[model samples]
Target chain A: MPTLIRAEGLTKYYRRPRRYEGAFGGLRTLITRQYDEVRAVDGVDFTVSDGELVGYLGPNGAGKSTTIKMMTGVLVPTGGLIEVDGTAPWRDREKNAMHIGVVFGQRSQLWWDLPLVDSFTLLGKMYRMSEADYRRRLDGFIDLLDLGPFLDRPVRQLSLGQRMRGDLAAAMLHEPSILYLDEPTIGLDAVARDRMRDFIAEMNRESGTTIVLTTHDLVDVEALCNRVVFIDKGRVLYDGSVVDLKATYAPHRTLVVQLASGFTAARAAELLGPEVPGDVIADEGPTLRIRFEANRISAQEIISAVTSRCPVTDLSLVEPELEDVMRTLYGNRTIAV
Target chain B: MNAGQATCSDGPLRNLPAYLQIVRGRLRIAMTYRQNALFMLAVVILQIFILRKVWTALYGEAGVVNGVALADVLVYLTIANLQSWAMQDLAVGSYLYSLVREGRIAFDILRPAGFVPQMLAHLVGGTLSMVLFATAALPLVALVGTLGPPASSAAFGYWLLSLFFAFGISMLLNLIVGLGAFWTTEIGAFGMLFTLVSQFLAGALIPLYFFPDWLRTVAELLPFQATTFTPVAMYGGQLAGSEAVQAIGIQLLWIVLLAGAVRLIWSRALHRIVVQGG
Candidate 1:
């Protein structure tokens, strides 16, 4: 796949005016013209290939939205280079706009008073799409996003989920090659979130649309993204496959074992000596949980050791979740893998 | 490679149909405020009526004051009021400001169409709707008394031309003020100041001829006079021969100059533009 989006040494510094406290201080500050500079994005580098769904995950005020603004040409970058396709977004906004579609989850792009279909028609006209092309795309989206029920209703009256679907459909009406979605699934119910994730995955699979999604929802990243880019404090901490991320940062797995009647913790510990390499971390009411590195010991070895002394009833293995991995990665500010 | 580029690369001529469609949508939305439109039209008519009565009382039955006939003053007031309604596009500027303040200006920049032209088209549509509504309300007021037809067919025709450029100049001025939102949070004060200054100088209140020499010179120096007073004066036959030619020429020059200024301001605004909060 060819590289469709690229950012190298991307940086942005926001200069905010310093506010004064006292009544006379306001006037004095105006005369002094004091300002404070905050670095929103700092030397970030990344790329997205054609037909790729990349998740851009970051903490709050971590320059996620700032980078998106620069990429979409809404704000000029204070430093660094960014190219969507072959054009610099800020330098050549109109030309770059032709190839990209953007959706901001919190803000609506549809007209508040107009019907859903009217907004679509207006966008089609804005994009100069042919009637046949527009109709075909609208029809497909109407069915896919289930927007038929609210087609004629004013956008202001629709629920958040319904409005988001309408917005997603509207953004793709032009069928641009790339899509930038900032928190597309934010504030959605569980059902709606699942539906949205499925639709996004399908859009990438079927239409070959390169998607760069910024989201705080880890489920959205886990379900839809093949690659995850972890950013914190205006820098990229990790950028790799989702599976590789879990394998590296999240190496520990747990096993929950249920013992039969008359089982005792002393007996269980006595059977599981130092040879059975794993920790008997918890012992509560006829059950014992063991934690171990998956690469170090197999589940079979721990189960056999525990059952040798006490009657084992049932046991289940647990894998390390992405949430745990991400917590560790962000909290420590170090890449484990 | 060009398949994705086909929609937006057709150039301005080919995009005319799309722009017209946007204009139609805007016009429909504007027409939805029928009650407000009617109320505004009534206010303008009542304003002109009261002014006519005051001037008539001042003339003391002579029917001519300051070398201008009472009927001519009524005509100027009526046409100028209508032109003022037609140029009441301060909402578009405020809309631009809100979009910036709310950080939704992203949609404007991300769309394939250029931002300035899209806004200008929206302004044109809204202005046309206001003009039509105000024009339709004219006959009802004219039926009362004291108002007459334009001086001649040529003057009526030339007035339309001046009114068109007047709208252009007003839209550009409003846009310039709106772009000030990018630089400072005091855009509301600027907008109010702009309206007060423009209305006073444009002869919406008093005729430029009534102003003292220095005041009249100041009024003429600004483009506000060209928007309403110049067109109304031309329509009433007050500005004849070379005077009319110069008035229209000044209007054309202001349109060109202001349009250029808007372009420059818009470019700078986009460069340093900060969209606050999502």
Candidate 2:
């Protein structure tokens, strides 16, 4: 895939007038020449290729939204370079906007008072869509996202889930080559979130639309993104495949077993200790938890060793969660990617 | 992908239809508040009633005061009040300010349309809604005060042209004030100050003819008069022939100057856009 979005040492610094506190602070803040500068996005570099779904993950205030803003032409970077589809977003904003669709999860782009369909019609006109094409796309989205029931309802009258679906459909109506989703599933319920994730995946798969998603939802990243770019404190901490990230940061998987009558956790732990290369812990009554590196040892071997020696009635495997991987990464900043 | 790129061909004229659609959308939104519009119309009627009684008492049965007949003065004041109400409370500035403060301006910036043109369309839409109310108030003009034709058909033509220019100047000024949000998050104070000062100077509160000579001269030097006084004066024949044409010319000049200033300030504001919340 060709690289469609590129950022080289991108930086954004905000300068706010020094605000004083207490007695006459407001007056002092107005007159002060001194400014406190904040480096919102400092020296970040990354590239997103065509037809790729990459999760741009970060904690709160981690510059995820700032980087997305610069890419979408909403903000001019204070330093460095950014090019989207060969156009400098800030320089040729309208031109760049033609080839990109952006959805900010927190804000609805639909007109507040107009019916949902009217907003679609207006966006179609704004993008200069031919009538036939507009109808075709609208009908297609209405079917795909199940937006028919509330299509004529005013946006303000729709529930949060319904409004979010409308926003997603609106963003994709233009059929741009790239889509930027800023926390697209921020406030969605489980069912709505699944629908959103499925729609995002379908767009990338069927239309080959390159997507850059900024989200705090790890489940979204795991479900939709093939690759992940992790950032913290205004810099990229890790950039690679999601699988590799898990292997590197969180390699341990736990297998829990409930032994049948007359067997204790300690007895099972001792029985499995010599056969498997893992730390066996005697957990709650009659349960033994075994932790092992997935790459080094197979769960089958560990299970068999425990089942043969100990009378086990119930067993369950627990895979490492992306959330745990992130917690580890965020907790220990020194861990090399 | 290439099909989408075709829409980006750079031409201001090509995007006019799209901008008009935006105007239509905003107008539809403004129409949703029918109760608000009716309430405002009632307020305007009450204002016209009070002004008529006050001016009548002041005239003391005189046929004319200051070389202008009472009937003509009544028409001028009625029309001036209507125009003032129509042009006031432009949503462009306050709309932009709130969008910026709430960080919803990101959606506006993400569109394929130019920010300036979009705002211009919104201003026109908002003003059109107000014009609807103004049109409804026209029947009341005959009921409460005297109504007369313009000085002549030719003068009427000039007044129409002057009114168009007046709209342009007013909307551009509102847009310039809106763009101030890029530098300062809160523009409510500044917007209010601008509205009060401009309305007074534009002779919406009282005719420029009633101002002290020095103050009238001061009002004439500023652009506010171009918004209200110019069109009203032309309609009343207070400015006639070459004088009316010259006044219209001054309005056109102000539009050009204000438009240029909007462009300058907007370009600077674009680079300074800071997403407020995150």
Candidate 3:
């Protein structure tokens, strides 16, 4: 796939007036010429190809939204080269806007006082969409996203979930080739979140719409993104497959077993012998928790070895949580993965 | 996909229809609050009553003051007040300020249409609705005060042309003030100051004819007078023939200058946002 978005050494710096505190601070700040500089996005480089749903993952204040803003043509980079669909976004904003759809989770682009459908109609006109095309797309979105119930209701009156759905439909109504979703699932409930994820996945699958989603929710990344680009402190930390990220950051899997009354964890460990590579710990009464790397020793081998030696009432395998893996990644910036 | 692929050309003329739709949308939203229009009409009517009483009392036993007839002065005051009430749209400034404050300007920046054009459309749409409400108050205006025809057909034609320029000048001025939000982030004080200064100087509260020679000269020198006084005076026959044409010409010049200022300030504002992450 060809690269649809690219950033090379992209940087954005903000210079804010130095804020003072305590007595006479406001007066001093008013007259002061000094400014403090913040590097919002520092030397970031990444590429997103066509037809790829890449998760632009970051923690709070990680410059994820800043990067997205620059990509969406709302902000001009202070330094370095960035392009969307072969055009410098800030230089040609309207042209860039025509081929891309953007949704910021914190704000809705819909007109506040008008019925939800009115925003669509206005956007259709703004985008210069043909009447037939607009109607067909609107009907399809209404069916797919279940927007019919509140289509005529004012946008300000809709629930958060309903409004978010409306926003999603609005963004995609023009059928842009690329969609940038900044924290799209920020405040959604389980059912709404699931529906959102499903819709995003379907859009990527059916229309081949390249999506760059920035989210704190690991589930959204796990459910929709095949490739993930992790950034923190205004720099790209890791860019690769989610499975590989987990393997690199968190390699261990745990096998939990509940032994029969007569069997103890010690006895189970002894029976497994040194051939099976793993550590078995005594859990709550008559239970053993075995930790092992899948590459070094498979969970099946360990479970079979333990079951053959000692009678087990129940057993389960626990894979590492992506959230924990991300925590570890965010906690230690020095870990080169 | 074809819709997405449609090439967007940049220019006001090409996007006129889209901008008109935006204007229509804003007008519809403003009309949603029907009570607000009625309230405005009531306020204007009450204001007219007070003004008529004051002017009548002041004109006591004098059919004319400063060579201007009482009837013409009443007509001028009525039209001036109505124009002031109808075109009183600080929406552009307040809207820009709030959108910037809440960081919701990203939506504006992301539209295929230019931000300034969209905002101008909004300003016009809001003013159009107010003009509608003002039209509804016309009957009351006639009953409460003098509402006479223009001095002549020529005068009426010049007044119409001058009013168009007045609208342009006012909207552009509001836009310039609104762009201040990009720098200050709070335009409430600025907007209030603009309203007070423009309303007083534009002859909305008091006609330029009432001002002393020095004060009238000062008001005439400024663009505010072009927004209200020029059109009102022409309609009242206070300015006629060459004088009326010159006043309209002055309004056109102000529009040109104010439009240039708006463009310059708008570009700078965009630069500020781009650099500062607005």
Question: Model 3 in CAPRI terms: which quality?
Answer: acceptable
What are the per-residue Cα lDDT tens digits for candidate 1 across B111-180? 7778888888778777888878877876776764356778888788778888888888888887788787
The sequence of per-residue lDDT tens digits that candidate 1 reaches over residues A63-126 is 8999988888888888889888877888888777877888899988987766788888878877
lDDT of 3 by residue, A1-337 (tens): 8999999999988887899999999999999988988888999999999999999988777888899999998888999999998889999998888889988898888888899998998888788877788889999999999999999999989999999999999999999999999889989999999999999999999999999999989999999988999988889999999999989888889898988888777877777777678777776478888888878877778877877788999999999888978888888976533
Q: Considering TM-score, where higher is better, how would the candidates rank from best to worst?
A: 2, 3, 1
lDDT of 2 by residue, B15-94 (tens): 77678778888778878986787788778777777787888888987888999888777888788778877887556677
Query: Which 10-residue window of candidate 3 chain A scores lowest in summed lDDT?
Result: A328-337
Clashes counted in candidate 1 amount to 0
lDDT of 3 at B68: 83
Better of 1 and 3 by TM-score: 3
Q: For residue A193, what is the lDDT in candidate 1?
A: 94
Q: For each candidate in turn, give its C-alpha RMSD to the true structure in angstroms.
A: 3.7, 3.3, 3.4
Candidate lDDT (C-alpha), each: 0.82, 0.87, 0.86
- Residue clash pairs of candidate 3: none
Model 2 chain B: lowest-lDDT 10 consecutive positions: B1-10
Instruction: Give the lowest summed-lDDT range of ten residues in model 1 chain A.
Output: A328-337
Candidate order, DockQ descending = 2, 3, 1
